[model samples]
Target: MSKDPEDRLTVGEVSRRTGVAISALHYYESLGLIASERTTGNQRRYPRYMLRRISLILVAKRLGISLTEVQHVFDTLPLDKLPTAHDWRRLSRLWHTQLEAKKREIEQLERELMGCIGCGCLSMKSCRLLNVDDELAELGPGPRRLDAAQAA
Candidate 1:
């Protein structure tokens, strides 16, 4: 379909253009990661640029960033206007810090895994190193931590 310069996109159209499922678009909207306007018929219509926003969100998620963190990053932008190239460059610069931190974390995990494997210290108490517990303690409370049963 030929799109008019001023025409807004239906959710389905946005999905088709972005290659994201319509339900996911709705979820993104609900999460305030994207936005839309309601038509007279109560149908959701989005600005054309939301396609790019969705693409950015997908990329950020793939990088293991949470939606909340992505929303915080988006908060740096002017909500009423589409982002300019300078805005994208500034945002990309912020991402480098995150990328570096992830790289370091991965490197540490690699060393820990290698040490554990080499020493045959898969069990917690008998291990000479404390890599697994240390990382879990840093993470606080999460599924990454050993459950009580597993800890025993």
Candidate 2:
């Protein structure tokens, strides 16, 4: 007998409820981010808990987080059970830190671009931000002063 509609959802139902495509849900399953059970006829069926996980995956991806990174976060939760309130809270804290770091990096990049406009690579002798002096050559190629990122 088929499961009642309230307890488990068919792939189409999940897609309809979440606005995610059936193929995407299958992709998520292949990535081990979400799981489903097979019916006797080998049809896919998902527990309602997947909605929460899918929502988180979508939101994290929107923030530029890769699915692999999100899977790493999910790995920290117990494999045998659905995620709990505390689990989501911990994930939120971890993502909040990552997002804050990214925000800072973007801000720094913007400032450096502004500084670059002023420097114009015109003053090789005095441009600390762009030109790599002989003194910094020992550290190898690439921008010598970017590690500190003082932005000129």
| Number of the top lDDT candidate | 2
Clashing pairs in model 1, backbone N/Cα/C closer than 3 A = none
Q: How many residue pairs clash in each candidate?
A: 0, 0
Q: Give the range where candidate 1 is weakest over 10 consecutive residues by summed lDDT.
A: 123-132
lDDT of 2 by residue, 93-124 (tens): 89999999999988976765676785576553
Q: What residue pairs clash in candidate 2, if any at all? A: none
Q: Write the per-residue lDDT of candidate 1 for residues 67-135, one digit (tens) a residue.
A: 888889998876545667887788677777888998998898787667678576455443435544555
lDDT of 2 at 137: 65
Candidates' TM-scores?
0.76, 0.74
Model 1 per-residue lDDT at 64: 79
How well does model 2 score by local distance difference test? Answer: 0.79
Best TM-score goes to which candidate?
1
State in Å the error of residue 15, model 1. 0.3
